[model samples]
Target: MPVILPTSIINILSNLFCILINISLFYLYTFKIFYSFQENEISISLQIIGIIVNFQEILLRFFVGYYDKGEIIQDKQLILLNTLNFNFFYDLFYLATLILSQIIMYNQKNSSNLVVYFLNLIYFLKAISVNKILNKVDQLLYITAKADYIYQLLKLIFKLIIICHIVAVAWHLLAQIETNYFEKNNTWLHDLNLVDSQWYSRYIESFYWSTTTIIILAGPKGSNNIEIIFQSVIMFATMGTFAYTMNCIGVILDEQNRKQKEYKRDLEIINIYMRKNNLKKSLQQKVSNFLEYLYQEKGDIQVNKNSIEVLNKLPQNLKDDINVEINSKIIQKFKLISTNFSQKIIQEVIPFIQEECFLPNEIIYKHYQYDNLAIYWISKGKVQIEHQQENAKIVLVKVLEKGDCFSEYQFFTGKQHEYQTRSADFTTIYKIQRDKFIQTIQKYADDYEYFNMIKDQLIFRNGSIYTNIQCLICKSRYHRENECEQIHINKNKQLTILKHLRNQIQISRKPFFRKCFYFIKTIQLIKSCELCVNQIKNNQELFNLIKYIDINNNSMDLDQSLSDNYIQDKVIKNRDNSNSSLSSTSIENNVNDICKQTLKNFKNSIIINSEQINSNDNFKHSQGNKNQLEIKKELQNINLLTCIIFINIQIKRQTDQQLKKQAQIQIRIQKKQIFKNQSIQKKKKKFLQKKNLKQENPQKKYNYLFKIKQTKKNTQVIITQQKKKLVI
Candidate 1:
């Protein structure tokens, strides 16, 4: 028969087992799981707290171990002393025992009625809280760090606990079954008499015993060697489980710590950058708040922590896959993209689509600003579009929610925004920058249609209604309803005016042309007339001689008839050759009169020539007398030159004597000046040497040299001045 343990003993051992289990898993729950989630200074404090918490459990376990011993440890003082050595609140008890007990109870290590239950409840609460914290940490780590080891370990731990419970239940049920079978066969195994009414009682008893045996190191007072071996095996298995869990927790902690540190470092770098840039307090606060919001939203999600950096670092294929997956929803939600694009085009644009986050009331873009280079599609939260007036008043035009987009219309059209868009709350959006959009679209042939559709849609929406109905030409609205006032001339009127102007110009030009033509003709006529007159004048002598002969012989009519006949022939020929307005008869008449005049003039000139010739002879005789007088004057000038030459020779003798004496005096003065300059230079050199011997003062030496140079310069100037005076 198996020996059965006392109920009191079993209860104490069960509690002891629970405490051991809690102690073994304390680090795994608190430090490895919970504290590891934080990548900040707070995490360090948490880790310290975890260490303290785990130590508390261990201390309780120590107390239980010592308490499990027999009455030999009955001395309360000894028990207290031993506990105090390992306790965190050992110093608190020195002042008062009352305070000490209260502290011990508060610390969950009091020895009093229901103390064990209280400790049990405390351990259970700790375990539950730790577990919850661990779950949260695991979720964070899974998202941001994308760790698999911790997840696998967590699953394994849960499975192991279930298996442990199952194994314990099965073992206890087997023992109970064996006992029942023996008793039913009326055999003496342990006189186990089981009835239908006691089934619940029996089940509870088995479960309790199994739990105690599997968990507690101390075996139940029992029993066959087989039962002892079973308990011992479970004990050994639990220790192995503890060891495995510890090792797994160590690895998880290390990985978590590494990621936490990196996150912390990045945040610290951002803060440092803000401080270094002398950012405004308000701006700094905004940045800090935004970062905190991001942390809260993503909470260590893989797409939050270094995800962008990772994507940048990834191979092309993997990068595209990730980007497409992340941004596919964002693209699909956009009305323009979904309606006009193909799957292929969407995939092509995925690379250009970047996720952006903004805080509440954050300005995404300003009204009527052309500087924005990207289109924003809201994936979460609402955006407010405000129209800003010229007077700086803001009017809320529209409120856009999920699946709605902003900036795309103006962004694509390359026009200024009609309204400003701001985040109504913490917002997540997908944006495609201008350069990236163009680059991506260009790579895919199908994307052109999609891009065109977007452009067309934007154009339609933006131009759907004319905000201001002012005329484009005159900028007037009320005077002309939806139309511009026409101030420009019609085409027909313009052509008529131009033609009229041309006609007027032609009419005005007629007089000028006529005048020019008449003047040219008049010049030609005058030239021809002059030529004819010249020809007539050249034959004047012959004509005049004929006239004179006729007059003297009393046959003037005969001579006139001959002269007129000759003049008529010459004038007729001149008139025939020239295109001037002259008649042959007129020319003949004028020539006849001119011939009579020339005959009279010739008679008078002949008489005048004879008188002038006599006067010229008398003038020549006077000029001959004047030539004789000029010869006599040249003879006097020759005599004066000889006397002047004698005086010049006497003056040259006196100047030559004076020049010789001056040259001798200048030579002597030059020699003396040279000797004096040489002596001065020697004195200067001696002075420099003496100054050098006295002390090596560069300043003094420079001053001395400067004084000497000045003196020499002055002396040279004086000498030159004196020499110049003498020369003069």
Candidate 2:
């Protein structure tokens, strides 16, 4: 047969074993130090080891919540009821109890056995009482750990308490050593009456003395001036430590009291608000019940509606700083907000969020009854997102705990609400309205198109089907209902890129021409897509091309007949100058071939531009005119400013090029006329010289001077004729 012990006995034995193990390990560790080193080395080494272990244990508890990392195991349902300092307190208490019990049992010769038994019983009871207090402290630590700063403060307090206890124990040890040193020599300074015979009794007596000195109470009398001086210094330190500890405790208590008062004041204000508004009985009751639930869950109510309103009225930067300091972590933990946006955006958004509270089982919104409006971030308690069926039955879709968000999909998508949300308990949330959200995002978003892309992605993710909706102008989505001004803006950008592409093709070197052409073709291809197509159709500026342009899949035909006629007339003029034998039929055919090739070269561009203008009609739908007009006006102002700057630069460049070309052409013409005049003069002079040479040889030789004069006269006459012709 197996023997079994009761659970209570087993637990007590287990605790005793743990205490024994700690003491044995500490003894062995101290013994190792004493054995391996000299006396002075041992003292310093032990001090170093104690300090290291104390801080190391504290840091481990602070960071990992345990002294030993390997002992930690994650369990969802497990609740830790022990604190970091509990182990230190428990060990010290157990050691003191054991020593006291041993002393009481052995010192019975001086007292009755019954009195010793009663003292032991009292000692055990006191141990139990201290254990109960430690257990309560452990429970309190569990709650404080939920708050980061509070948890750290609590840990710091525990560390201080342990440090003080260690100091007290060290003081007791020092006092025992001092007493032993004086008593063994039979010195007059040693008071045998104050010192106990047993080492344990002496240590206990020293501990009581040390406690009195540490608390700034009456302490042991000193024997000499030197002792008195040392006691005075120790007394001063004790007073400072006591004061510091008291200040810390007072500060913590004051903070707790302040928070409690604030909570109570908020509840009163909420009651007043409800009365002023003359809210319905059901609504008032809901608020009342929520206040009660809050107290139960959090042990305090925090109704800050007035505070939120005050914060909202402050400067935006100040408001943002305050909200971020308080609620940044609460907002960042939500999946939608964290994954979709950056920290800066989150910071900007923090100011717009409103703190809201909901009662248990309170309906936030019903499915199909409200549009996708606001997003709710749970800061405390829980909420249930329920999907209501067509038959009016509700199914719980998800239970969102603290740090989760509700209606987030709606905020991103602009879709109608798909589900209803209800508070599962007393809940607090940070609410961000859709319009405010959009306004905030527009500040950081690059442009309306980028913003629209985010919107589309959100809508698609939420399972909204967008196919089969025809936008006649842009030939994309159903623009009449959607009414996106961004479509117009994007169309303007595509046109700007097309114009830039043309400029690059004209100015770029031959080696880059092919690349430029390919790039233009790519832009044109992109422009033919749904977004750009809608942009071109809806925009007032780009809508004019539809009246006289035709775009086919393979061939671009934009005002083809007019272009053919222009090409033929140009060819005819060229023929007249260089080919007089060119027939009308040959000229027309040549012009047609040239036109065909030019069209082929620019076929991609024409098709893309014409595709933008395929639809002749305009959209009549308009919504949010003030907002759209304001944005449009702002864009127009920006574009006009940029265009003015760029156009002036371009005009200046073109004027310089034209002046340079004209100057070069004039210089070349003057050079040609000069050469022609010089040749004519030389010819005339040569002819006159030949005639003079013939006359001079045999009476037929003419006077060279007369010949020269005649030639000059001839040259002068020619020059005069040219001058008259030029003047005419």
Candidate 3:
């Protein structure tokens, strides 16, 4: 098991032993006259005590657990190693030397005093280490106490005493050492006529000299060079010690007067502000009186505000408990809350119960004020409610003291205040807004219903029935402004109003610029639409088909309608001339085929134009250059002819698909027959041209034509021979 010693007791005992050791060492060794073996009973007694204390400490090093980096080490091996590493060997050496010196003094009466001096020196060194340990213990005690000033003063006094004792012993030692160089009578001790004085008297004189020199720099002058040098060194060391002592005292006094200093600073700032604003003396006095009262009542304004912020950072449950502790009495005073609400509901409302302070006669709320729609509970001081009679006389209604509530009926009724409320004195009140209270209770269904019922009862008792609340914006009784139907309508109306304003501004501008801009935009749109239409019209075959469809179907009028009609008339006349060759069904089939092809081409053109317009819109949107409104206006200005064509295409798209398929098949067959007929007609034309050339130049032209025919026949015969060889 580890041995545990009370550190406080150990520290006290150690300090006592250290003082005894220092006194014995200084007197017995430094004076030398008191070093007689027979007369050193006091010194020997101290040495015996020192031996016991040192032995106890050595045992403690091994048995008692010591702090290693804040944790206590109790393992025997580790504790033994730790003890051996620090001061254990040195302590053992000192103990051995002390024991040897004691043994020598007892057995050998004529032994040298050098051994006693060495033993005293070792004991003094051990005492110095004990002083350091005591200092650490003092610091620990000081940290655990509240009286910092007292602890510091005590510590300073103790250090001064120790320094004086050490210096006194050294000063006498220096004087004794100087006797080696010169006669003993020539030293400072002899100059003071005290060389043969008793050891106690000599020690007292040395201590008095050290104290005076160190504290006040007032002491006898040195008689020799050694004495002068020692005195000068002591003076320098004391200068710094004195400065540090004064500094510590100053810090203590400053801490004690910190509050007063802050108060003065605040007052100075207020005075400067008043002077800069040039306030009247009477008003300034009133302000000063208020400030005095504020400071007396509240020690520091910033401290209170900082405390509130600190409280807000606490956990919610902890804050709730604190709030309950602060306002439980005030909450119990409210009959409506205490009787009707559950504990949980009361806790929920506590967070929103804000505390407000008011000065004497400060108007908290005026009569019929819409903003004062919250319940007030007086937590401190008094409140006075004043009502104005119909005869224009102000009457004091009642004086409300602590725990009294006002405006409870108004809070539930959602009505304006009927009386003015003012603070009767320096008052503190807790306010709970009606909306926050309702919102908190809403989480509990039963509590919310009960609250509403109480609110209705309160309103009825005041001779006013609860009615539906109308929307503030639209005056609709069914819903609030946020839920009103007119909100979207109002938004659209705002847009229209902005548009009208813009149009009015444009009308006020120069018409020439506006007209030019509109004309340019229209021209650009027309050009784009015409470009798309012209691409379809540039196809000669599709254009011809369009003309035929326009002539036969007469579905809609077009730019080429007159020409188409004229061409149709000529074709009809030719058909009339060859009425026997062509039947009516063939004419109708041809017309139908032409119409189908035209409609297909029109649909494809419309699709391409639509795709291009959509792509342009996407590009403009990506570039963010043109807004949606501008794009819409440009689309609206498209050519009217394209609109009509699109309408006609849609109507034709609804036609029977079987007729279109049949027409397509007939058209393909007729195209092949026409191609064959054209080829045969070209051959006949070539033969006719050859006959004409032969008639014009009989010999040479006819031989040229015959040679061309012969070359064609030879090429055909060579192609047949190559085919026959491949077959073989």
Candidate 4:
């Protein structure tokens, strides 16, 4: 049977294998002690293993998926393209060098040290592959174990160890160069008397010297300027390393103790607040106990506050699922909800189920209290339902344990509580407020109707429920009967004469006939006032009199004339013969005669005035005809100027009309083009639909095609009609 390893296991194994190969190659290259082995078998074997590891890693890059941002990219082509980039070339070069060096050593039997050094350098570059191992290890530590402080501490320690190892290797390499290349006798190896030491001893001495100098700044004396310079450089690098290590340790310790510190600070703040408020000892003790219990129940985080923020950040579906999971137990407590509702309806209400904790013997509500009317379900501990008797003594009604609900009757009926509720023990309750629950269920019409029906049935079975008395004026349940009396008083105060006039004016302004009627009434009022009549005459207001007469004639005509004649005759007769009135026929005749005589006299006066003006103008003309010619010439010039202006206005009007017509024609053409495009799109969609129908249902294919042809005929008719209209 073939073993199929999981992706995580495969990744871990590959990372470990790469780390082992890199470390082994690093050690062999650094020490070079295996060079003394027969035929250099150990070194050759290590190099071969490294070449194999590198080749496999490069191959895996083409097959294995990689993470880009947060998403895993598993496309084979993408993997191959990415593998051919910079890392691929570097790996290929390293592999070729290893192979070449191995061949040279095998062929020569005694290859130059340069080839080995070159191989060492190439392997040193391969050390960067250990990053993959560190990354996987980091994921295991921080994600799997969820110990950030531990991961950070391990990271800092690993970095320090790598730095120490590199420094040790560099120190030994420098010593080798000084002694072997420069032929010097005053190197660090000579000073320590380790020139003839075993490979292990030399390595131990170099590591010890590097660690002491980097960490404590104390080691064996340097015998040359080159050694001193190297020590100084190491000292400077050590300063930075030490600073970084201290900072990492500080952060790790702080993270480990953060929760404890927060808890202590909160406890101290609560105590200080209690002391500042001068609260009673028993009350303070109760508060402290509740705080302690809260911490024990919810741990370091404030679950209610933090959970609300977390739930808000989550998607709607996830939030709904979480709410249902946490509060599904309390859902069965409600009779209406459990019997009449489905799981879907219950899920809608779950989001509004808020969890609250109560201390032992704490009063959740009192008898007859109108506020805090919510249905409560006991999820943990017990609740004591109490009632107040006629004698004002509290009686225990019942003890409601887990899965029991209370206050549901008051919530549905909008009534005050009949009995008080107190916690018998440290209880946890899931409460759903009446308003929120009603609003949420209202979104689903069927659910809301069924809920209402079920609520009514439940209320009927539970005996009489108190209903609020609604006010008659405002039609609100919250207003008292006495408060309605003030509305009547305010209405009466607002209905004064000025207010009535304003309302009539506003009404008159709304309609044409009302406005005309109002204008006629105002004219009648002005006619009745003698002072207004005199003012009109003095102002040459004949047009006002004529307009008033024309309006009266249009409305009343003959009756208005008869009334005026009768009134005038009555007034004249009264002056001539006291306590006497004239007949209607005589009054009408007398008024007509008086009007004719006045007209004749006015005509004679106008004729006489015209003759006098003509006589005066002829006398002036005899005195100077030259002045008359100059006046005629000035009049001709004024007439010509007026004619030119009128012609220019006519030309401008013609141009404006032509431009307006052109704009209208362009707009109509653009609209027709848009309609054509829309029609074409519709025809294409219909044809596509017919093709799809032909594949799905062969029988419907002919029907769909006929429909499409009918639609095309109708569209063509519409286009032709539109074109004829545009031409017209």
| lDDT (Cα, tens digit) per residue for candidate 2, span 448-479 | 34546656854554222322223323434434
lDDT by residue (tens digit), candidate 4, 78-131: 766766888679768878877887787777766556776577567666763556
The parts of candidate 2 lying over 4 Å away from their true place are 1-39, 44-189, 193-207, 210-296, 300-319, 325-350, 353-359, 366-372, 386-398, 401-404, 412-419, 443-447, 450-728
Q: By descending TM-score, how would the candidates be arranged?
A: 4, 3, 1, 2
For TM-score, candidate 1 versus 4, the one ahead is 4
**TM-score for each of the candidates:** 0.33, 0.30, 0.37, 0.43
What ranges in model 3 sit over 4 Å off? 3-43, 74-76, 109-112, 129-131, 139-147, 263-728
Per-residue lDDT over 1-728 for candidate 3, one digit per residue giving the tens place of the 0 to 100 score: 54553344654466456555645554454444332233466767866776776677677666656666535566788777877864678768878877777787788764466766577566556655535655655654654445456777776777777788778887887887777565555777887787777777778888999988988887877888778889999999887987787788788879868866777788889989999999999988888787777666554435557878988888776677778877776677666676778999887777777888787888999989987488888878899988787898887866888987777767777878778899987787888888888888899999888778866765554222333333444655444333456644445577787888784434465556334443448888678667646754765764565565466345323323443343344344655324422433454566556555655665576567557757775565544434444444333433343354445555544432333354456557767999999999999999998878867868878688789999999999999999999999
Which model is ahead, 1 or 2, in terms of lDDT? Answer: 1
What number of backbone clashes does candidate 4 have, counting pairs of residues 3 or more apart or in separate chains? 0
Which is superior by lDDT, 2 or 4?
4
**Candidate number with the higher TM-score (2 or 4):** 4
Q: Pick the TM-score winner.
A: 4
| Candidate 4 positional error at 185, Å | 2.5
**What C-alpha lDDT, on a 0 to 100 scale, does residue 295 get in candidate 4?**
61
The global Cα lDDT (0 to 1) of model 3 is: 0.68
> What ranking emerges by lDDT with the best candidate at the front?
3, 4, 1, 2
